[model samples]
Target: MRRSRAALMAVVLATTASGTAAVTADAAPASATRATACPTGWGSLAEARAAATTVPVRDVGTGRHACFDRLVVHVPGASAASLGHRVRYVDRLRQDGSGRTIAVGGGAVLEIRVAAPGYRPETGAPTYPGRAGRPLPGVDLTGYSAFRNTRYAGSFEGETQFGLGVRARLPFRVLVLDGRVVVDVAHSWGAAR
Candidate 1:
């Protein structure tokens, strides 16, 4: 009985070691594995909001992640609960209050509207000097995997607008963080591993 128990333990250990080795040998590189493990939970749909705020938009920026591209709208002195936004896929980007179409470079355009003006509330001075039908100053999406262009639609009344041109109408999500509104567009609609 003692000899049989010892043999069983030895076999179990051996099997576990071999299994681990096999998995290690068959594993893909980290980046390749992560490409297939991209998150797909963020659906491709219009995220709408009607609420407004007094905080003015300060800046707009973009970044690239491993699985997604990010667009951030900076609204200084504003809390997440104090800001409102609307993000949706659009056939063509149009300027706010002008009804003029703005040309974007990507296969699809994501329209972003923040419920805040681009002007200082106290003095009405322009906080974000972005103009309609022009590429945003200092923003270059040259090598980004998902983003092709970034254009300023306009700022009218109490809202600021932007047009994000992407590779396709991909899954996306919006996050209203403190002092900012973040939009993430996934590289693909694959299931995360």
Candidate 2:
């Protein structure tokens, strides 16, 4: 009877280990899934931040704080080009099932080509409940009383310029669960082509 009990315990341990492994495999892609396309000239977020001059924060909410950054690029034989802007905001909830999200934007560079207010996009937003998937649909950006009440993400594809200049705005509400990045609430603003 003791030997039989030991065998049963070993089986339970093996099953639990396998379940944990499966969950980790499923989570490998969530972080990479939430990235936006940087401007044409800039390669990465760090590079863009290096060129940007720090600005003041706006719109702080409960458990949330916001900060802004601006970068002015010197154009050839002309006025310096304002590449884009970034807003970094974070919210930490202390309640049960709490989490954190991050939002980064390349500004109007990713605007949908032919979107008008009150018009839905051809594609729907991507939904990822902490699983392997692509970035959430930019279409979710519709109807948020945004910078100009415009459709920031969709099929639009031209200058993609919005806001004060070329700077893209990326707003995110992240949830931190037990010190890990999970459940992201991200928003962006862009103009039509």
Candidate 3:
């Protein structure tokens, strides 16, 4: 994987192309350099000190990298606390507001719940507006080997819900960088050592 660095607002995004990787840059150079070991055979569960902010989610983006597939949720006013997430493999995805079962193509579903808002505070307008069953379907995986689909369940209370469809149940990681929350799912489960 080829690594390159760039500055985004107060963040720095170090990206690797070809066997690519997604990166985000913020104020602290050392913080940006902190790495998450997402190689095959790693554990799926993770928790970290949630950054503090109440920023609303505005955009959702994705990337294909050498080791994993990435999903990035952009929250303009987000701090570390606001981007905290709970990710786990679930039997099925249920809409946040509606509690309806969502169908996605893959052997497993990783339910992502971010501890942030996805709407305007005063008016309650949706920040990351998406369809009920499938939000932000524009993030296409035409040639991706691991990722099948990214579905938005909903945003209720102060949290936003999302689901990632993978070829199989695999190791995944979540990170909060600057104004974004990221999810990286490995391409393979790895063979026995």
Candidate 4:
């Protein structure tokens, strides 16, 4: 009787696995992984915004700071409840991509890429423009270490979108204008959900 029960259980498990595999196979054909080729610079801000929803990106722009709004993106995982708390942080310092460090605001510097036990900083993926319907590879910064809770990467092109810096494992599209960093997050490809 015991042997029969064990055999039945094994059959049930195998059937479940096969069912899952079949479902996955059926869903696979709905969409394909299209690669994105974003150009060095996007044509306009509106176009950039539209692109953000679709894939990974990095861009810069200049314009009149919106009269009534100063765009700001807070550190990930930050909240009103955690104000003044030492959360890994990132901010704009010096010029864009200059590697210069200056305190533009109150935050720490980003050091590590991902925030796991053994993680290292990674580079931004290759980008191309004028290639429509392609997918942008997401940035992976999950285990990255920050200097003094500063996890913000540098600005895209001197834009002031705070907390818009190099991130790990977070799929994002960046739009930099004036003094703001607009970050659009895609689904993370290599981080815990």
Q: Top model by lDDT, which number?
A: 1
- Could you tell me how far off, in angstroms, the CA of residue 41 lies in candidate 4 after the best superposition? 20
Order by lDDT, highest first: 1, 3, 4, 2
Candidate 4 lDDT (Cα, 0 to 1): 0.26
On a 0 to 1 TM-score scale, where does candidate 4 land against the true structure? 0.19
lDDT of 2: 0.22
Q: Estimate each model's TM-score.
A: 0.80, 0.15, 0.75, 0.19
lDDT values, one for every candidate: 0.78, 0.22, 0.69, 0.26
Return the top candidate by TM-score.
1
**How does candidate 1 fare on TM-score?**
0.80
lDDT by residue for model 4 over 9-94, one digit each (tens)?
Answer: 56446533322111122222222353222223211122222112112223221111101001123223322222221112343333
| Tens-digit lDDT string for candidate 2 (1-193) | 4664465456446533322111122222223444423222212121111121111111111110012122111111211122222323212111112222223342432221111111112343221111111222222322222221221121122111111112334433222111111111122322110
Where is model 1 more than 4 Å wrong at Cα?
Answer: 1-36
Candidate 3: stretches off by over 4 Å: 1-13, 16-41, 46-52, 191-193
Of 1 and 3, the candidate ahead on lDDT is: 1
Question: Candidate 1 on 18-58: residue-level lDDT in tens?
Answer: 22111121232344433334666798899976677888998
Candidate 4 weakest ten by summed lDDT: 62-71
The 10-residue segment with the lowest total lDDT in model 3: 1-10
Clash counts per candidate, in order, are: 0, 17, 10, 46
